[model samples]
Target: MIKYEIPETLKEHENIIKRTFRYSNEIIFKCEETKPWESKLGGCPYLKNIEEYPVDEEGEPMLFLAQINLSDLEKLDDLPQKGLLQFFVVNDDMFGLESPIVVKYIEDYEENEAQLIKENPYEDNEGYKQSLPFSNNGKMYFETREMPISSSLELFETLFKDELSEEEYEKLSRDCYSCNSRVGGYPYFVQHDCLGFDDEDFLLLQLDIDDECGIMFGDSGNCVFSIPKDALKNKDFSKVIYDWQCC
Candidate 1:
């Protein structure tokens, strides 16, 4: 969930806001110094062999963006109980949208570090190109919570007016503290560029522009992945919609 408390202006309608937006279960990845095989934001990926490393459609090796060890997170009903979910993006300006975005699931945990991909994938120490974003190789510690995520301003305003008359809702819409690296929450984007998104879709991941983590999108922006509720419950990453934007 968002770290900031609810705005004082909307405190009166707290219950109403909560009632309107369904609380989405979320896992916040705390990026910190960690080991190689642990769930991490940027680091050497977890793979059985060299062949398992991902590459884009043009045969260029993809950069490892993140690896989420599902077993490291709380046992949420929608998430896998155990395994690793890894994300790889092309080393280009297109990121994963035009190029291929590889989302892989390792069902069984490989405990031994020696058995995993020990050698760094990138030839030099450069994880990303000058175009691709950069974040430190920090370990991911999961902080799970329920969040009342709003999709768009239009939907929020409509719901707000319904709960209370326009006169009653005398204040501006409260600020949303959503631009953080998180998972399984309703996505809030700087640009409403969600092309294939609909009501059926929920946020699978939001790798936001984290200044603290040194992660940037294009120009001070973030990316989000939306997936059908059933697709997430079934642990199906094939149909994931990946979109990133900048301010």
Candidate 2:
């Protein structure tokens, strides 16, 4: 959940003044519901209004901040969900002048959230399903382990061996992406994409070759498994993930 707060000092910033004017103008045009001279100024429903005052901070114009309500963060936990933020400007022209800058602010929000939830989609879901958060492609790749290898080189050998001749192996070796990091070393699966196995751990290097990578593993490799993406959306991953090993 994110809360917006405008500092009293914002009135002194040149950029803030521009944003306020733009936001105020947008609100006015929206209320009137008429198209601007330039078609670029389209209507947005989220921006409620913009207000201004006569007072100035350090000789700059005083402006009321634009109030915007972003999507409820709690409800968006999967790839198909859409989240947005909106700003209300006083008139179309005013907002047009500052659209480029204000749009940057919106993009920033998306980038920040993407990084935080890339792996742990259900971290905030309290508790519902127990499974790792994985992109559709990611889930397919990591569902099975090829075979245990004693070292990084051995792992690479297992993937290319028997399937390709010596010449083909040379070409594959040149193209293959390799990382010798401890987290994805021998005996562990390497997925093309990742899934959150826990708050701190992830299923790494599993390439979902066919998009249907679902598997359950236990001591005897006798665990029932299915694609849990549908069941896990908007639910907590911690509650659904049952077996996890960490070295």
Candidate 3:
């Protein structure tokens, strides 16, 4: 559970603001509904404890000093209109690292521009399903591993020990697109196009050739896995993923 606090003075608020930057955890904003609640990761309903709720000395709900400033709220690109606004700070609990994020619950709130960000942030990046505080279908670009190797052959060798002949490597390393534009970093299992050249770097790795999935490496190691359309019918392909989207 996260401990919430309300800064009493501008100095305390300033300290909190500084702590936001210094903390090792990555803080993300989320709005949780109390009445018809929705998880940040989506699906089930969530309810905050009324008794354990962070309140002032008088037992009233405490609001952070910085949260009272509209200017600070404007700085957020996407803000939600309803529910309690929480800063879900990501921390590695295994190492005894705790999140210092504070949740601010308010009533009769007006909508803000920052709320435009999609709700479910784990649409494609399934890896974040466990880490994120709330559930939403938003795009997650967090890369747990390093970007793909520069050489396609090297990347192939890294994933599969078998060496690809020059001809085979050349054929697979053709003009590839990264979805709509050139997105740097890792790739995921994506759709194909009529041109045969979709957002991928390599050709389909046949089951006979390599049981594991094949990845098409792009510049800066941004890549997409090469799974045949027919393979989509198999649930295993969906389970194996290498998340490497740039922030």
Highest TM-score: which candidate? 1
Best by lDDT: 1
Tens digits of per-residue lDDT, candidate 2, 197-236, equal 2122222111111223222222212110112444334322
Distance (Å) between predicted and true CA of 11, model 1?
5.8
User: Model 2: number of clashes?
Assistant: 28
TM-score for each of the candidates: 0.81, 0.19, 0.18
Which ranking of candidates, highest lDDT first? 1, 3, 2
Clashing pairs in 1: none
Give lDDT tens digits, candidate 3, residues 1-247: 1222323332323342233221011112233321222212122112233343344334433211112211222222222333432212222222101223333334344344233332222224444343332223221111111122222233333432344445543432331111321112212223222223222332211101111211122222222223333432332233222222221
- The weakest ten consecutive residues by lDDT in model 2 span 20-29
Q: Which ten residues in a row have the lowest lDDT in candidate 1?
A: 20-29
Question: What is the number of residue pairs that collide in model 1?
Answer: 0
